[model samples]
Target: MKEESSVSRLQIMSVMGLSKQRNYLLTQYLQAIQLPRGFGGDLVFEFQVSQGRVRHLVLDEQASSLKEQTVMELIRRSLLAWLPEESRSNR
Candidate 1:
């Protein structure tokens, strides 16, 4: 979803392969997070999958109108992107 290209898809697949190799659960049917395309126009989508199904799917229409919340989510995602999928303690 980051970029609509074959290379991006391949990167995602590669990460999934790495996750499996590291014993991370692969049962999540799908996982996605979609931020609003425009302010106050669309809902923010956050979907989490567990046990081959959706455990939570938050659709916040108001999030688009709340600049603070949107900024927080952006920051959170950025921070998360910087984190290792497996903590050092796991090794």
Candidate 2:
């Protein structure tokens, strides 16, 4: 992982679009682990795999300026719902 944000909203959106456009079999399972305000008000999104590979995306600077509630709503509407079904068994 990189010190800078490894994942961004645009990157995630691009993946979603590519999945559709290319008809690739990709499953993205995202869960809101917790609201870690101590970490500069970041909302943590954890992407888990059955093989024990876990990737986390902390919505820090990208969402730092927004209220907690607003951030949550934005995530729910834009990111969460766009995530593909959990293909844990396949992984």
Candidate 3:
């Protein structure tokens, strides 16, 4: 379990790095949202946006019963709501 967790963390970082490398827009978007808590935990949520689309938000860890798809949909709706018209319409 601990090994899987470590691998997941590394994978997330690699994905984030690739996202930043492949898409400057995504990198910039991610920068807008702040992570109040560092990644990896059960009690905190990390925020990010990519390709002008918000990424899935994980309020709970993988061990929790929360659905990942639902969480992502919620984040998408939320990002749309929070973003200004110019930002949304332009994409």
Candidate 4:
């Protein structure tokens, strides 16, 4: 039972880490005016905010098996964690 719980925890953490990595990549590509039309098999996140703040994160070759909705949820969670503590925008 303990081993099972530990494995479960690790799996959850792995998902979270993947989400964070995707977010970080997106932040790096925010300003890209042109991107590959398709990345073959990868999870891509295009995050956009007001005032021209745009972020594009990608998890190339590492997220092909995940559903689109799942990936989106991960993106949402990562963004929520990233926002400034003082920001009034509620989830």
Which candidate gets the maximum TM-score versus the true structure? 3
- Lowest-lDDT window of 10 residues in candidate 1? 8-17
- Across residues 1-91, which tens digit of lDDT does each residue of candidate 1 receive? 4974322110123232234633233212112234344333223545453433333445455654344576446534532343233443444
Best by the lDDT measure: 3
Of the two candidates 2 and 3, the one with more favorable TM-score, higher being better, is 3
lDDT of 3 at 73: 51
lDDT of 3 by residue, 1-91 (tens): 3544222111122234334433444434434553333234322345465555446655545543434454445444544444433446777
Task: Compose the digit string of candidate 4's lDDT tens values, residues 1-91.
Answer: 3533211110121233234544454454332322323222234443444332324544444534545564445544664444422233433
lDDT string for model 2 (6-73, tens) is: 23321132232233522233323233333333323345444332232323434444644545575466
Deviation from native of the Cα of residue 52 in model 1, angstroms: 2.0
Which parts of model 4 are misplaced by more than 4 Å?
1-41, 51-65, 68-71, 84-91
The per-model lDDT (C-alpha) reads 0.37, 0.39, 0.42, 0.38
Ranking 1 against 2 by TM-score, winner: 2
Query: 2, model 3: CA deviation in Å?
Result: 52
